[model samples]
Target: MTAPASPGGGSVRPEVALAFAVVGYVALAIFGLGMTSLVTNQEVISVPGLGQLPGIVGMTLSTAAFAGGLWAAVRRPHPSFWGVPGAMLGAFLGYLVGIWGAAVIGGTDLAAATAAMGMLATSWFGLVVLAAALVCAWSGIALVRTRAGRPRWPWERDDE
Candidate 1:
């Protein structure tokens, strides 16, 4: 069998990194919103530790998506430092889209939605973006440290 390709060489192209970051963040936002709505729209008994389930689920999904995006970006033959900035931009834009969508669905005008959500909600959204950025950065760094190839399983033979 041919040997695996090397991980380092050309850096990740800006356009490719941006595209991946945007797609990943948007998908994460959509999934998070859907999960939150599903959990909160239903009336169920309040469990002691389950009160924050929706928020937890949303955060978890977003974090996973951000990390996955970073991993994919860095795994490109030409991994670059641009992935971190791309991730931040994508996270901010995706959160904006989520806010706009929620406002539209709630039958509120943009101005009214902003007023309704108030400063605290806006701050929370910012926090979410920050968290996603950090996750993406961490993932990118980890990927950069590793070799590019399918990991060997314990049950698999050393020789391919």
Candidate 2:
């Protein structure tokens, strides 16, 4: 639950971390699908049973960000920038999971369908996810913590 720190990030209060996690997932869900639709020429986001695709990209990205943020939050270094790599790695892994998941949900071949899953990476979706990760990563760091606790301005804290 604790990572070695070398210029790492501050230990975020649990509530703040939880809040950021919620906001990150929701933000990525919207942004991921928005970017996907924009690039794929879809008027609206795709669904699980849409055609041959599972339409789970948005969900995957959001989940990945959440997982990655958690990882970064708990990392020893706690470096603010750690979220970038953590979330990106999470996204890639999430994509693989999506491939298999789509195969299962769509009743298709996981092996054969793997090659066709390049649309997201090959398109603008990758960039969007990266942006989302950065946003997600900074969520807690931006609070300007004065002490090890919830995000409140210095003036808001009462002397104990």
Number of the top lDDT candidate: 2
lDDT for each candidate structure: 0.48, 0.53
Candidate 2: where is the Cα deviation over 4 Å? 1-12, 39-53, 57-65, 75-80, 110-112, 141-160
lDDT of 2 by residue, 1-160 (tens): 2422223344455445546755775578567758767777863322233353544653555465556555555443443545456665575556545754665667656544453455555556655655665666555444322234446667776753
- List CA RMSD, all candidates: 8.9, 6.3
Model 1 steric clash pairs: 10-78, 11-78, 12-78, 12-79
Q: What TM-score does candidate 2 reach? A: 0.59
Give a tens-digit lDDT track for model 1, residues 1-160.
3234345432333344345554555555545445544655632212222233333433444455555556655666667666676556545544444444455454656664454334314444455465547554644544444454455576664665
TM values, all candidates = 0.44, 0.59
**Residue 106: error of model 2 in Å?**
2.4
Model 1: which ten-residue window has the lowest total lDDT? 42-51
Spell out the clash pairs found in candidate 2: 3-76, 4-76, 8-77, 8-78, 9-78, 9-79
lDDT of 2: 0.53
